[model samples]
Target chain A: MIRFDKISWSAGSFALEEVSFAVPAGSYAVLMGRSGSGKTSLLEILCGLRTPSSGSLWIGDNEITSLSPGERGIGYVPQDGALFPTMTVRENIGFAQRIRGEPAAATKATVGSLAERLGIGAVLDRRPQNLSGGERQRVALGRALASRPQVLVLDEPLSALDEELREGLARLLKDIQRDLKLTTLHVTHHRQEAAQLADHVLRLENGAVVRESGPPQNG
Target chain B: MTLRGSRWFWGLLAGITGAYLAFILAMLAATAVYSAPSDLWKALQSREIQHSIWLSLCTCTVTALLSLFIAIPSGYVLSRATFPGKSWVQAALDIPIVLPPMVMGLALLILFQTWFGRLLEKAVALTYTVNGVVLAQLVIGAAFAIRTMHGTFDHLSARPEEVAMTLGCSRARAAWLVTLPAARRGIFAAGTVAWARSMGEFGPILVFAGATRMKTEVLPTTVWLELSVGNLEAAVAVSLLMVVFAMIILVAVRRVGERV
Candidate 1:
């Protein structure tokens, strides 16, 4: 479970005040907001990228407001995939393991399994620059999942795709979320995506969570 | 019509610039061939010329490598960090580029004459030594390298390093693993440029290191030494050697810059 209690952040002319919410364990939550509404800021705060001006965050039993992103056990996929342009898909997926000095064989196994699960095994040798939009997103997903974190945070992973590709990846994401039972916080502006994939939805306006909804109907 | 007027006008301007470069290259080649192969071969075999060539190669290599060691972290911080007096620091870095080489050498010589230099000289002498030559070359070479590296890191996104940090690497570790590898092309370009600049450095070495034969006689000073002695053939030969060395380095720089 991920919970934010009375979270507030202020910078320059923008402020997000008393934004409180929770995602039950093993459920997928979508955060919807217009541009400049602080949805990305909220997600950033949760993943330890940005510290709240005043507030506390808890992931399951751990109070993560004091922890670094690496210590918080959160996997984040930023907008545009942000895959390391110089690394092959396999190296990108295996990066966390490599940094931690894991054995080469072990790192390879982890990368192989993640690539297979993400259906990106065929393109493991290719660099991020060579991959298509969908392929790049999938490679990014495999990289994030390689570390096996409890929370998966995605920032508009499908916003750049075509309508047909978006629908396909959305279904694939929902299926993967269910299969892994990950506590996920997905950010997007598209309500149709929220209705399609979210077990719960929260809409933010001007830095506040203005609405919350129960799970969407089964397909 | 545009200020540039037409394609023909631009082509003519470009052709003039290209002709000037061709003329300079032809002049160097003509001078080199003015003397017979036997004369060039005899000049090359001179013990002083050989020693000067060897000294130039060693001192410039040392200076370039030392400059890179300082440039990498200095460039990264200058490019990526925001701090008090950032503009002041950047202005200080530009001094070597803007300062006259003779003035820089005079400054170095004065520094070595100070109490601090007197203390240092007790243990290891710097003035008029081969080590002084390396120091003189490093002063300008490192400044150029730092400029290139700073530009390189500025162009690279901070997102990759942030992502690496999220993946459990500390900030330094993230930079080492991801940022440095991604910046390989920039590193190569900086190193090559610094090496070439060090090889061509003259004024500072002449003033600080002093052109003592077989001691501080680098390729450039060798040409100077030959000219003062009225050995026109020897001076031309050294000049030709410098041209050849510069040509090789420029070619390497071009290849690396393309990749970057």
Candidate 2:
């Protein structure tokens, strides 16, 4: 579970005021908002990349507001993937486990399996710069899942893809979320994307969660 | 709206660039033609020339390594951090670069006479010693290296390092494992430029480290020594040697750096 209580932050002249919301355990929540509506800032704060002026952040029953990003046990996939350009795709996916001093065999195994599962097995040895947009996004997803965190935060995971690729990846994302049963907060401005992947939807407007609703019955 | 709309505009730009290249090449060519290959060959065999060449190479190498050692941290800090007086700090770092070579040498000459320099000299002699040659070159070389590093770090995105942090690595590890490796090309470029700058250093070495035969004398000092004695042929030969050697090393470094 991921929860934020009374989160308020001041960035330049813009303010996120008294924002409170929760994503229940084993559920996918989509936070929808227009550009510059503080959606990215909220995700950044939750990922521990930035700090909220006044707030408490909880992940899986533990208060993680004061913890470092590495200690938060939260996987974050930023908009551009942000892969380490010095390494191959295989190495990028295996980064967390390698840094944590996991056995080489186990790390290699995780890289191999994640590569296959993400349908990027053919490009494991290739660099991020050489991959297609959708392939890069899958590499990023595999990288985040390699750490096996209890919560995941995605910022515009499918915004850069074509309509067909976007729909295909949306279905893949939903399947992965269901299989992992991990609490998730995906930030996007696409209403169709939200309806397709979100079990619950939270609308952020004017720096607050103005509405909450379940997916459409047909969806 | 477009600079290329007129063909004369492109021709004008290319004209000045070609003229500049021609002038520089002519200067180097004049030096090469002044001494025949045989005179250059004979001068290269002289003991003084040999000693000066060896001394210059060793000092320049040490100066390059030290420049890199200091440049990395200084560059990283200047690029990434915000402070109360950042502009002033940047200006201070530029002092070595902007100071006239003679003034820098005079400052170093006086600095070694102070209490701290006296203490340091007791450990390893710098004033008028072979090590003093390195000190003089480092003053300017490190300044250039730091500036290069500062720009290099500035151009690199912090995104990769941030992602590394989220991947459970500390900030330091992320820099070492991600950022530094990514900066390999910049490091090579900085080191090569520092080494090249050190090879050409002349005025500072003359003022700080006196030209002592087979002792503190570097190639630039040897040039001065030869000119002082009115050995015009030898002086021109050594000058030409410095140019040729500098060119060869520069081309080699560029190739190796590109491969890396």
Q: What is the alpha-carbon interface RMSD for each candidate?
A: 1.2, 0.9
**Residue-by-residue lDDT tens digits, candidate 2, A1-219:** 788889999867999988988888888999998899999889889988888899799887799999988999888888888888889999999999999999999999999988888899999999988999999999999999999888989999999999999999889889989998988899998999999998888889888885468733221
| Local distance difference test values of all predictions, in order | 0.88, 0.89
How high a TM-score does candidate 1 get? 0.90
Residue-wise C-alpha lDDT for candidate 1, range A170-216, written one tens digit per residue: 99889988999999999998889999999899888766675478853
How many clashes in each candidate?
0, 0
Candidate 1: what is its chain A TM-score? 0.94
- As a whole number from 0 to 100, the lDDT of residue B71 in candidate 2 is 93
Of the true interface contacts, what fraction does each candidate have?
0.62, 0.68
Candidate 1 B-chain TM-score: 0.93
Candidate 2, what DockQ? 0.72
Error of 2 at B70 (Å): 0.9
Docking class of 1: medium
Error of 1 at A193 (Å): 3.0
